[model samples]
Target chain A: MTSPLVTVTDLKVHFPIKKGILAKTVGHVYAVDGISFDIMPGETIGIVGESGCGKTTAGMAMVQLTPVTSGAVLWKGRDMAEMTRSELRALRREMQLIFQDPYSSLNPRMTVRQILSDPMDVHGLFTGHQRKERIDFLLDTVGLSPGQADLYPHEFSGGQRQRIGIARALALDPCLIIGDEPVSALDVSIQAQIINLLKRLKRDFNLSLIIISHDLAVVEYICDRIIVMYLGKIVEAADYASLYKNPRHPYTRTLMSAIPVPDPARRTRRIILKGDVPSPISPPDGCRFHTRCPDRMEICHKQEPAMRRFGNRHTAACHLYTDEQAEPVENKPKAKEKIS
Target chain B: MDQKTQASILSIQNLKTHFFSRKGVARAVDGVSFDLIPGQVLGIVGESGCGKSVTAQSVMGLVPNPPGKVVGGKIFFHHRDLLTLTVQELRKIRGAGIAMIFQEPMTSLNPVYTIGNQISEMFRLHKKLGKKQALAAAIDMLERVQIPSPHKRVHEYPHQLSGGMRQRAMIAMAMSCNPEILIADEPTTALDVTVQAQILDLMHRLKEEFSTAIQLITHDLGVIAEMADQVVVMYAGQVVEQARTVELFQHTLHPYTRGLLASIPVLGHRTLGKDEDLVEIKGMIPSLYDLPAGCRFSNRCPKVMDMCKNHLPDLIDMGGGHQVRCWLHTREMIS
Candidate 1:
């Protein structure tokens, strides 16, 4: 079997919390304490969580857009954390990130032609007429009119601006693209257009994608594998079918159940978890989700469960799957042991 | 299910709101109509620039002029046409009769004012209560919306509260006067799923307690399905379809509505793969200023016909209160 395109191992990103006029370090906000995942070539991996679950931080850390506090982001067997500036700069040409907000991502002053061609000029890919052709090709590739290359970013609509963003991401001819909340800002109709465009481009270019979004519907639709993050830790990771069909972790189940399905007639039972997510600065000891988890155990409060594998490449970090000898019957808890 | 028996708190008929810019007249809400019955959740679902918010604004008599005006239509709240009411008369009815909550709480709320001050102002102005009484009432309102430690939270500014708590404050302010109707425009769109669910559930509970009719305007069909009992599907500033939530989702008539239902990637079910493509409405929403002479959706509609290109179709009732604005349905009824 071929090797994976990217592998992230125990990646942690911590931001120091400062206090007073002296700006002394008080504590640290563990944005991404420790997470791990792998992205196979031509495969799409999605990381989903709420506002400050560190899904975005992990994604940024994977691409070296953010500084890693610990662990490694191995790009083709090379640890990116140890790479030199020039080496990392060269690595950036093969992997790129698309920001969430298209309204602010693109330069309002730059024309479409200039934005797409600027990257090529820096990389010294094509010169003269060849560069112009490549810019037009990138624009057309993202379903924008090549003739509109002369137009500024402001001249386009929200969806059109996103197309320009995709074009720019593809300008460097990268093999991997990490889109952070790519279609979240677009209208529903426009979201469908962009999702389709991304799918088409992924197949056509054989590009590995790591799409990070809070929208489960969009993630489930486009991604091959999914990682559920909570308070900077990965709770579950599985193939789309297995994850959606049979979510193992209590957090994963609650998150999946929370998403309102479009069909009104087919009403599914929902497990609405109460209370807000705990502050990441001081995440709950043991299992971070034990605070709001419905099927939590007494042991969950004292010990953090490691990632345990189920069948079909599905894995969940939960105490319910602790007993190895017990047959995982839909992976439900066996008994309610009283807390000491 | 007789419409006469079930009284409507707010009724809009052929509402045409246009934004008159220097370039042209942008018909934002073009001949749209809907009725919100008391205690019922009437969702108006559409994409951006589809006039769902404009319809809500029209009901509130809050359409900014010089650029926008309600060119034609009647917004009847409690059998009285709101358009004909004097500004002073509307002022009396604004919070007491009809209340509204906008999408962005940070922008909608006054930054300088404390949560208590902002909420108390509602009671002070509408209820004609004294300062101390209004402040006490505001704390009560905050507590009702499930804001923990209302006393402390009331003193805090909008920035001090989290997104969910801020929305709770907004809801508390809107419901302070016990208005008969509430127009919530994308109330939970800016929030996370957990918080969205919390707010949606809170709204549902509030509706049960107050029996206040809600005009929920959003682009999310999933939220609409979860909350709305009746739905209005709008396109290009026009009502393309209207029906019971279950009926509309089960048997969508308009091609545009069908495309919309097909386009969304639902959780727990996904058929679109590497080989298959998701169904998408072909083109962008037509320019509101230069809308199609016929059906506004004709340009992007996959099932477009020759008749759809030349003449606009009426929103004909197809029995059981399900209305569809399409030549195919209208032609079928005629035949």
Candidate 2:
């Protein structure tokens, strides 16, 4: 089997909180506190969480857009942190990030052709005539007409602007595309068009994608693997099938139940977690999710749960499970005290 | 479900709001009509530029009128035509009769004022309460919206509060007056999923407890599913489909409504193994100032007929309180 395209091991991105005049570092906000995952070639991995959960920071760190506080991001068997300036520049071509807000992400002053051509110019991919031809091809690949290349970003609609963003990400033909809430800023109908475009691009380009979004529904639509994050930590990680069907961790289950399904008659019994996600600067001890977890145990308050493997390629950092091969058929553990 | 029109807490008929811009007359809200039944949630779901929020603004008399005007339509509340009311008369009914909460709490709440000071203003203006009593009422309102530590939070400025807390504070101010009808326009759109759930839950509890009617306008169908009793699907300044929540979900007559529903990827949808690419409504929303000759959604309709291109479809009633505005459904109405 081929090795994974990207591997992120124990990645932690902590931002310092500075106080008044002195600008002294008082404490650090644990944005991506020790999260590990892998993206196989041509596989789409979804990192799902709420706002301020650090999914965006994690994505930025992987692409070197944000300075990583600590931990390792292996890019094609080379450590991203240790790479030289030239090596880092080359690594940029292998990983591209599609930002959330299409309106602000693209420079208003630039034309669609300029937006698509800048990356190629930066990387020295092609010259004058060849670059223009490539720009036309890129715009066409993203379902926009080549004639519209002369128009500025303000002339296009939100969906068209997003297509331009996608074309920019694909300018270098990167193997991995990390989209941070790619379609969150668009309307439902426009969101559909963009999602379909991303899916088609993935298949055609054979690109591995890390979709960081608060929306699980959209994530599940195109992902092969899923990770549920809470308070800057992964509560559950599994293959798409197991994660959706089983959802071993209480946090994952809460998140699944919380999603507002389109059906009216079939509204699921919502597990509305009490209170907001605690401040990430000083996350709750033990399990990060225990504060909102309904089935939290006494042990959950004092000890952080290890990753318990229940299914093939499925693991959850929950305190409920014991045996490695146990099916976890019953969610409630009768043997141990379950603090409801 | 055919109730008396006289019983509706708020009734809107053929409301048309136009904006006079450099380009031309932008028909933001074109002949839109809906009613907020007593203690029920009336949802207006639509894409951007569909006039959902504009419809809400027209009801609250909040439309900025140098370039905007409610040129037509009658909004009848308490047997009075709100359109005919003077600015002074409208202000009398604004907070006490109908209160509104916006999507962005930071912009809505005054930055310089304390949370209690802002909320207390509602009590002072509507109830004519003294400063001390109004301050106490503000804290009570904060508690009602589930904001923990109301005592301390009431004194803090809007910036000191988190996003979720600030939203709850906005709700507290809206609820302070105890209005007959609450018009919430995209109230939970800016919030996170968990916070959104909490806010929606608060609205539901408040509705049940106070029996206040709600005109809930949103782009999210899921929120509409969970909250709305009557659903009105809007497209480019007109109601495309209106029905009881269950009927709208079950039958979904309009092509635009069907396209909107199909576009959203429902969670756990593929667990039963019906995997396929998302069904997209091709093309963008037409510019309101220069819309198509007929149906706004004509360019994107999958079952577009030649007749749909030049003729506007009527909002035809399909009985059982379900209404659809589409050429495809016009035949069924004729039958």
The top-ranked prediction according to TM-score is 2
lDDT of all the models against the reference?
0.89, 0.89
Every model: Cα RMSD to truth = 2.4, 1.9
* Residue lDDT tens for model 1, A1-340: 8898899999899999999999999999999988988889999999999989999999888888888999999999888888999998888889987888898999999999888887888788878889888987898899988899999998888889999999999999899999999999988788899999999999999999999999877898888999999999999999988888888888888888888878787666677766788889999999999888888777888999988888867888988875573235364556855443
What TM-score does structure 1 among the candidates reach? Answer: 0.95
Please provide, for model 2 over B1-335, each residue's C-alpha lDDT reduced to its tens digit, 9 standing for 90 to 100.
23645878788999999999999999999999888889999999999999999998998888998799999998989879899999999998988899899999999999999999999999998899999999999999998988988999999999998888888998889888888999999999998888888888889999987788999999999999999999999999999999999999999888889999999998887666875888899899999888999888999999899988999999988888788889888886568
lDDT of 2 at B199: 86
Model 2 ranges off by over 4 Å: A323-340, B1-3
lDDT of 1 at B76: 80
Q: Write the per-residue lDDT of candidate 1 for residues B203-304, one digit (tens) a residue.
A: 999999999999899999999999999999999899999999999999899998898988887775673233355777777877787888898999988889
- The RMSD (Cα, Å) of candidate 2 is 1.9
Instruction: Give every collision pair in model 2.
Output: none
Q: State which candidate has the highest DockQ.
A: 2
